[model samples]
Target chain A: MSLRPYLTAFGLQWKIGLRYRIAVVAGLVAQMWFGAVTLMAYASVYHAAPDVQAPLSLRQAMTYTWIQQSLFTLLPLGCLPAIGDAARTGAIVYDLLRPVDMWNWWLSASLARLLGNAVPRAVLLACVAGPLAILVGLGAWSLAGPASLISAALALLSITLGALLSATIVMWWNILTARTLSPLGSYAVGTPLAVLLSGMLLPLPLYPDWVRPFLLAQPFAGITDIPIRIYLGTFIPGGVATGLGLQIFWLTALTLLGRLWMRQTVNRLEVQGA
Target chain B: MTQSPSHTLSGPGLYRRMAGASIVAQLRYPGTFVIQAIGNFVTTLLSFFGIWSLFHRFGSIAGWDIGTVAVLYGLVNVAFAVAETLGRGFEVFGGEYVRTGSFDRLLLRPRSTLLLLLGHELRLRPIGRFLQGLFVLVAGLWLAPHVQWSAVLVLPWAIAGGAAMFLGVLIGQAALCFITVEGLEVVNVLTYGGVEAGQYPLTMFGRWLRRFITFVLPLAAVCYYPTLFSLAHPDPLGMPTWIGALSPAAGFAFLGVMILAWNRAVAGYVSSGS
Candidate 1:
C-alpha cells in the first residue's frame, strides 16, 4: 500500500481540524478550570489527613491525577460511529478505491484527528495545569517532568491502540453496536477498568494480596499505572522496559485481532465514496 | 377556512405529550435499557468500593465516619441519576446531537427547546444508580442511627434540589457547546468532578476549594449543608442549621440561571452558527 496518499489524507484532516482553533482553546480552558478544582479538593483532603496511606506523596497523587485527567482526552474511546456511518453511507468503498490501504488510511485520519484535537488541547491543559500544580505545591517529585512526558507518550500509544481495537470490533458488529460501543464502551468498560487497574484513583500496592495479580494482569494497568510508575521512579529501568514490553504485547494482540475482524467484515462493506 | 394560530398545545399538555413520547421511545428498547441500568449500577457501586477500601484502613476521614460519607455519596448519585434520567439528551447534546447538527431538528419543533431537549431522551438505566444510592443512603441512616422524621421529609427535597443542580450543570455544558466542542472536557470538572467532590464532605477539601464549592458552585448548599442538617451534624460553614435544611432550593435558582444562559447561547448559535 502507498503511504503518500495516507499522509496526504492525514494532512487534510489536520488542516480541517485546525480551522476550529477557538473551540480547541475553549476546551483547554475548561479542562484547566476543572483540574484546578480537583487539585484543590485533593490538597484539602491531604491537608486534613497528612498520614493518608497511599503509596505516593500528596503532591505526587495530585500531579498524577492531573496527568490522568489530561491524558484522558488523548485516548480514543472509539470513533466507530464515524467508521460505521461512512461504511453505511458507502464512503468506505470510495476510500478503498484510493491508492492507500484501508487500515493505513484510517490510521492517518485518526492521527490527523489526534493532532487537531488531543495534542493542542493536552498542551493547553499542561500549560494551565502546570501553574496550578505549582501553586498547590504538587510538583515536588524529582521525576515528575520526565515521568509526565513518558506517561503522555505511552498514553497516546495506548489510546491509538484502543481506538484501533474498537474500530475492528465495529467491523465485526453491526453499526448500531459499533456506534454504541465506541462511546459507551469507553466509559463503561475502558475508563472504569483503567481507574480500577491502572491505580488512577488508588495505588496497586494498597490492594489486597490476591487482587493485585489479577489487577496487574489487565491491560488497563499498562495504560496509566505502569507509565506513571515509570515516571515516579517507582519502577526500576528494567521494570519500565517490562511495562513497555507489556504495552507492546497488548497493542500487537489487539491490532492483529482488529485486522482479522476487518478482513472478515470487508465482504459485507457498503460505503459512500467521499 | 382559516385556522386559529392559538391552536397549539401549551403548558402541561405539551409537557405531557413530550414526556409520553420520550417514555415510549425508551420502552422501545427495554433490553438495552436494562443492560445500561445494570452497567450504571455496577460502575457506581464499584466507585463506592474505592471509598469503602479507604475506610477499611483509615477508619474515618476528617472526623466524618463511613456512614456520613456514604450518605453524601448516596445523595450525590441519587441526584445525578435523577438528572441523567431527565437530561440524557442534554447531557450528550454537546458531543452527540450538537456535533452532528441533529440539534437543529429540535429547533424545528414548535415546543419549547428546553422541554423538547429534556424530553429527547430519558435513561431508565440510571435507576440502577438511584437504587444503589438508596442502598447507601439507608446504610448511612443505619450506621448513624439518626431518626429525625423532619430530616427524612427533607430527603426527597434534597434529591430534587440535587437533580436540579446537576441538570443545570448539564445545560450549562450544552450552552458552552455553542462556542466550541473541543474543550468540553472542562464541563466534566463540574459534572463528574462535582460528583467526586460531593462524595466526600466539603470540610475534607482545602479552605479555598471549600469556599469555591460553597459560594461559587453552591455544591455545599446542595449536599454538604443539607447533609449536616439531615444527619444532625454541626454546620461547618457556620450557617444556620435551617440553611442546611433549605439549601436545596438554591439548586433550582442555579438551574434557572443556566436556562437563561442556555437561551442566550442558542441565540448566539442562531446568529453566528458557530
Candidate 2:
C-alpha cells in the first residue's frame, strides 16, 4: 500500500551494491580482458569465413561483444546474494515479516542491485572500450556506438525493459533460493542458462539457422540480444516493434507468474519455516 | 591415547581417508547432490551448444575446424572440472577458511595444511561438467578422423597438468585473502576467465596475447599446444612441433610458483596476527 518501504529497500540495496568498489574495478579489468579475447575470436571467425554471409558484420559483432561483456553483471546470473545468505542463516523469515508488498519490495531491491552494479561498470567500460580505445588509436578494435540517433534512443528504451526482464528472472531465482534454502541451486542453474541463452556466449545471429529463431524468441534474448541487435541496426525479421513487444510481453507475463509462485512459496514457508 | 608406530598410515593413505570422508559427507544429501550435479552438467552442455551452433554455421574459424576447437574446449572443461571437484575447498578458502578462522583449525591438525586442503578437493558435483566435456572430446575426436595412438596417452596427461594449473590458481586466490578478501574475485579472471580464453585457439588472438598466454599464463602449454600436437596441425607461428609435448610442464611450474606465493601469504597472516 505504501511506497516508502519498497523505496527504502531499493536505496539500501543500492548502497550495498555500490560498496564493492574494488570488485567493480577488478571485474571491469576482467571483463575488458575477456571482451578483447572474444572480439579477437570473432574477428578470426568472421575473417576465416568471409563467404558465409553472416547476419552481423565483424564490426557489429565486435561491438556486440563489448556491450555484452560490459553488461555481464547486468544479466540475471542468480538470485540476490543477500537472499542466498539469509536463506542459509535462517534470517529470511525477517524478510517475510516486513510490512510491505513482498514482491514489489524484493523486485525494487533486485532492480536497484542490478542497476547499481551494472551502470558503473557499463559506463566505465564504454569509456575504455569505446572512446578511450579510439583515443589511443585502436579504433578498429574499439566498440562502435549505436547505429544511429533513433537506434540509440530505441536501444536505451529497450535496455531498460531488458533490465526489468532480467530482474524478474532473478526474482524466480530468489524464490527458488527461498524454497530450497540454499544459494547453490540458483547459481548452479542460473549462471549457464543466462550466459548461453542471453547470447553472452555468442551472438544470436551467429548461431545456426534453426536455432536462431528459438534464440530470438526466448525470454533471455529480450535481456540483451534484442537490444544489441536493435542498437546495431540489424534488420529484425519482424522489425523493432516486435523486439520491444516481445520484451514487454515477457516482463508482464513473468511478473504475473512469478507473483503467484512467490505467494505459494511464502505460504509453504509460513506453514513450515523459511 | 597411546600412539603406536605400527598403526601410523602413510601420507597417501591419510589423504585417501580424508578425501573419502569428504565425499561421504557430500553424498549425505543425495537429492541436492544429484540436482547440483545434473545442473552443472546441463549448464556446461548449454555452453557447448553455443560452440555446436557456431561450427554448424561457419564450419570452422581461423582454420581450426569445429572438431579441433571441440577438442580444446573439452580438454579445458574436463581439466577445470577436475580442479573444481577436488580443489573446491581452496576455491572457497578466502571466504570459508581464512575469514571464518578455520585456517587455525587446519593449522592445529598434525597433518600438513596442503595435504589437508588437497584431501578437501575430492568433491563429487563437478562430475557433470566432467561428463559433458568427455562427451564433447569423444565427439570431436570421432568427427575429426585424426587417428593417433599417442594422443590417447597424451590427453590424460594434459588434463592432469591443466587441472594442477587451475588448482594453483585457486591456491593463489586463497593466499590473497590474507591481505584483503574484497578483491580476491579478480583471481577469477585467471581461473574462470582462463577457461573461457582456453576454449578457443591461442592462434586466434593477436601476437602479444598469444605470447602472454604461452609464456606468462602458459595456457598454450597445457591446452593449445597439446591439442595441436594431437591433431598434427602445424603451428602457423611455427614455434616447434615438440613444444606441445613439453607444454604441460608449464602448468606444473606455474603450480609450483603459486605454492610459494601461498606459503608467503600464510606466513604474512601468521606474523600479522601478533
Candidate 3:
C-alpha cells in the first residue's frame, strides 16, 4: 500500500487546521473563560462542604479542568468539515472516485486536523495557565505539574494514543456523514456525546460512585479522562496500566468496527449515485 | 437600496414567512431533525447528570441544594437553546456570509439584514435542549423545598430576558465580523461560557468575575437574580432579591444596544471582494 497518498491527505488537513491563527486565539479565550467559570464553581462547592471526601481534591479538579480546556479542540466534535461540505453539495462524488484506501485517507486527514488544531492551542494555553499564571499571582489556580517525571512521560504516550482514539471516533462520524449525506446529524450527536463522556464537562472521577465505573468503561473515556488521571497520578480503578490498556483497546476495536462500517457506507454510496 | 418585492409583509412578517419556510425545509427530513434533537437533549442532560452527581456527594453547593441549582441550570440552558435557535444565522455569519462575500448580496435585499438573518433558519434542533431544560425546570420546581405561585409568574420573564441577552451577544459577534472574521470564537465565551456560569449561583465566582457577568454581560441579572428571587435564596453578595423581577429588562437593553451596533457595522461594510 502506497503511504504517499495518505501523507498528502494528512498534510492537506494539517495546513487547513493551522491556517486559522486568529480563530485559535479566540477559541483559547473562550475555553479559558469556561475553565475559569468551572473552577470557580468547583471552589465554591468544595468550600461549602469541607467535610466531604470528594474523589478529587479541589487542586486536582482545577488542574483537570485547565488541561481539559487547553485540549478542547482535540476531542471529536464533529466529522471533517470538508466531508460535511461535500455531503451537502454532492461533491462527495470526488471523494468516492479517489484511487486510495478510503479509510486510511480520511483517518489520516482526521488525525492531522485534530492535532493541528489542538497542538498549538494546548501549548499556548498551558504556558499561560501554568507558569505564567503563577508568576502573575494566580498560583492557586494555575495548572500543576505532572505528579512525577515518569508520570509525565507516560502521559505523553497516553495522549498520543488518545489522539489516535479520537481520530478513529471521528472516522465513525465521517462514515455517518457519508451515510446520511448531511453533516448535521454527526455534529448533533458527536458534540454532546464526546463532551459528556470524555469528561470535558466534569472529571469522570467526580461522577457518582454507582456510575463511575461505567463512565470509565466507555470508549470516550479513553480519549481524555484516563490520560488525565495518569498525569495527575490520581486513582484509576486498576491504576495507570488499565488506562493505557483501555486506550489501546478502544483504538483497536473502533478501528476494526469503523473500517467495516466504512466499507458498508462506501458500497451504499456507490449503489445510490451521488 | 432595492425595495423588498413583497412590501406588504413588514420586516418581521418576512421573517415569519422565511422562518416558516425554513421549518418546512427542515421537516422534509424529519428523521434527521429527530436525531439531532435527541442528541441535543442528551448532551445537556448529561451535563445535568454531572451536576447531580456532584450534589449527591456534597448534599449542596454554596449553601444551595440540588433543586435550586437545577432551576439555575434549566434557566440558562433553556435560554441559550432559544437564543441559538433564533440566532443561527448570526452565529455562522462570519464564515458563511462574510468569507463568501454573501453579505454584499444580503445588503441589496429590501428587508432588514437582521430580520433576514433571523429568518435564515428557526432551528428545530435546539428544541431538544429546550424540552430537556423545561423537564429539569418542572422537576426543580417540584423538588424545591419552598415554593410560592411566584415561580410560574417569573419563569417566563426570566427566560425571555436570558434569551434576549444571548441574542444580543450573537448580534454583537456578527457585528464584530465586519472588522475581522478571523477571531469570532471569542464571542462563545460570553454565549456558551455564560450558560456555564449562569448554571451556578453568581456568588460562586470570584469577585471580579462575578461583577463582569453582572455589570457587563447582565447574565446575572437574567439568571442569578431570577433564580434567587424564585427560590427565595439570599444573595451572599448582599444583592436585593427584588432586582430579579426587574433586572431581566437588562437583556432587552443589551439587545437594543447590539442592534445599534449591528446597524453601524452594516453601514461600514466593505464587501469581502471574494
Candidate 4:
C-alpha cells in the first residue's frame, strides 16, 4: 500500500493535537505543581530515612519526578478521543471501511497525537523546571540533566522507542473501543493502569524488593521508567543494552499481538441501527 | 394541554425522583454498568497498591506510617468518590450542557437549576471507588493504635464536608464554561490533583503549597485536619488538636462561595446571549 494515506492521517492528527495551545500551557502548569508536590514528598521521605540505602538518591528521585511530570500527557491514558467520538456517533464503521492498512493508519495517528501533545509541554517544562528554576535561585530544587553526555544520548534513543511502545499500546485501547462501541471502557481501564505501572504514581525503584523486578519488566515501565533510569545513569541490572532491548522486545511483541487483535475486532464489528 | 403548576415537586423531592430515573436508565445496560464499576475499582486499587508498595519498602515516610497515610488516602478517596458520584452532571456540564446549549432547557424548567443538576448527578459507577476507599479506611482504623469514641463520631461530618468542597470545585469548573469553553482542563488540577495532594500528610509539601491547599482550596481543612483529629495524631506543624475537628467548616464555606460565583457566572451568560 502507498504510504500517502497513512502520512495524511498522521499530519491531520498532528495538527489537531497541536491546535490546543492553551491546553498545553494549562497542562504544563498543573504538571509542574504536581511535580513539585511529589518532589517535596520525596525530599521529606528521603531526609527522614537518611540511614536507609535507597536505590535512587534524593536528587535522582526529584529529577525522575520532574521528567515524569513533564511527560505526563505522553502516556496512552485512554483510547484516541477521535475514535471514542466516532464510536459514540456510529461513525467508526467508516474507519474500518477505509481503503488502507488499518494498523499503520491508526498507529501513525496515535504516535502523532502522543508526540504532538507531549513534545511542546516537555520542552517548555524542562526549560522552566531546569534552567529557569536554577537561574531564579531554586537551583537545589531544579530538575537536573542527564548524568553524562553518553547517558543523554542513550536516553534520547531509549525515549524514542518508549514513545513507539506507548503508541502501540494505545492501538490496543483503540481496538477495545471499537469492540465495545464505547470510549468509556478504554478510559476506565487505561488511566489507572498506566498511572500505576508507568511509575507515574511512584518510582518503581521505590517499591519493595519482591515487586521491583515485576514493575521493571512491565510494558508500561518501558514507556518512561526505563528511559528516566537511563537518564539518571542508574543501574539497569544487566546494562543499558538490556534496558533498550526490553523496550524493543515489548514494542515488537505488542505490535504483533495488537495487529492480530485488530483484525479479529474489525471482522466482528457490528454497528446497531437506531 | 394546560400544565399544572401545583404538581411541581420541592427541590429535594424533584432531585430524588429525577436521580432515581437516571439510575434506572444506567441500570438498563447491566453489562456496561458492571464493567465500568469493576474498572473503577481496579483503577483506584492500583493507586492504593502503589502506596502500599512504597510503605512496604520503607517502614515509614517522614514519621508517617502506612496506616497513618492510609487514613488520609481513604478519607480523600471516599470524599472525592462521593463528589464524583453526586456531581457527575456539573463535572460534564461544560462539554455536554453549555457547548450544546442544552443548559437553556435546564433553565426553562420550573425547578431550581441546582436541583435539576443535582438530580442528574447520582451516578452509580463511583460505587467502586467508594467501596475500595471504605476497605482501606477500615484497615487504617484497625491498624491505627489510637482509640477515641469522638473519632468515630467525626468521620461522617468530615466526609460530608470534603464531598461538598469537591462538588464546589466541579461547579466552579462548570461556571467557568460560561466565560471560556476552552482551556478548562486546568480545573483537573484542583479536582484530581487535590486528591493526590491530600493522600499524603500536609507537612510533606512545601510551606507555600501547604498554605495554598489550606487557605486557597481548603482541601487540607476538609481532608487532612479532620484525618489528624480522628487519628489523634499530633500535627507535625504543631497546630492545636481542636483545629482538626473544626476545620471541616472551611470546606462548607468554600462551597457557599463557589455557589455565589456560579450564580454570578450564570447571570453573565444570560446577559451575553439573545
Over B1-274, each residue of candidate 2 has an lDDT whose tens digit, in order, gives: 5768779867899988888888899889998899889988998888888777766777786778888888999999999999898788787777777776778888888877778888865889989999999999888888765646778978888998899899888888778877875237788888888888898988889988888887778788899888888878778888786778878988999999999998887777752231
| Per-residue C-alpha lDDT of model 1 across residues B94-157, encoded as one tens digit per residue | 7776777777777888777898888777667789989999899889877874636776777788
Model 3, range A1-274, lDDT digits (tens) per residue? 8899999999999999899888888888887898888899899899999999998999999999999998889999999999888877888878778998888989999999999999999999999999999999999999999999999999999999999999999999998988888888899889998999999989999988888999999999998888899999999887899999989999999999999988888887832244
Query: Candidates' TM-scores?
Result: 0.79, 0.95, 0.94, 0.96
Kindly report which residue pairs in candidate 3 clash with one another: none
Highest DockQ: give the candidate number.
Answer: 3
Give the better candidate number (2 or 3) by DockQ. 3
Model 4 lDDT, residue A237, Cα: 87
lDDT of 1 by residue, A1-274 (tens): 4568877877886777688776676566655555565555455545656666655666676667666666554444445335556644655566557665666667666657655666666676666667655667755421146456766676556545544433333233333323342234434444444455556555554455467666666666665566656665564335656666766676677567766665655656544345
Q: What is the interface RMSD of candidate 4, in Å?
A: 1.3
lDDT of 4: 0.87
Ranking by lDDT: 3, 4, 2, 1
Clashes of each: 9, 1, 0, 0
Ranking by DockQ: 3, 2, 4, 1
Contacts from the true interface found in each model, as a fraction, amount to 0.31, 0.71, 0.91, 0.64
Q: Tens digit of lDDT per residue, candidate 4, span A133-182?
A: 99999988889989999999999999999999999999999999988888
Model 3 chain A weakest 10-residue run by lDDT? A265-274
Fill in the DockQ of model 2: 0.72
- Each candidate's interface RMSD (Å, one decimal) is 3.5, 1.3, 1.0, 1.3
Task: For candidate 3, give fnat to 2 decimals.
Answer: 0.91
**Shift in Å, residue A63, candidate 3:** 1.1
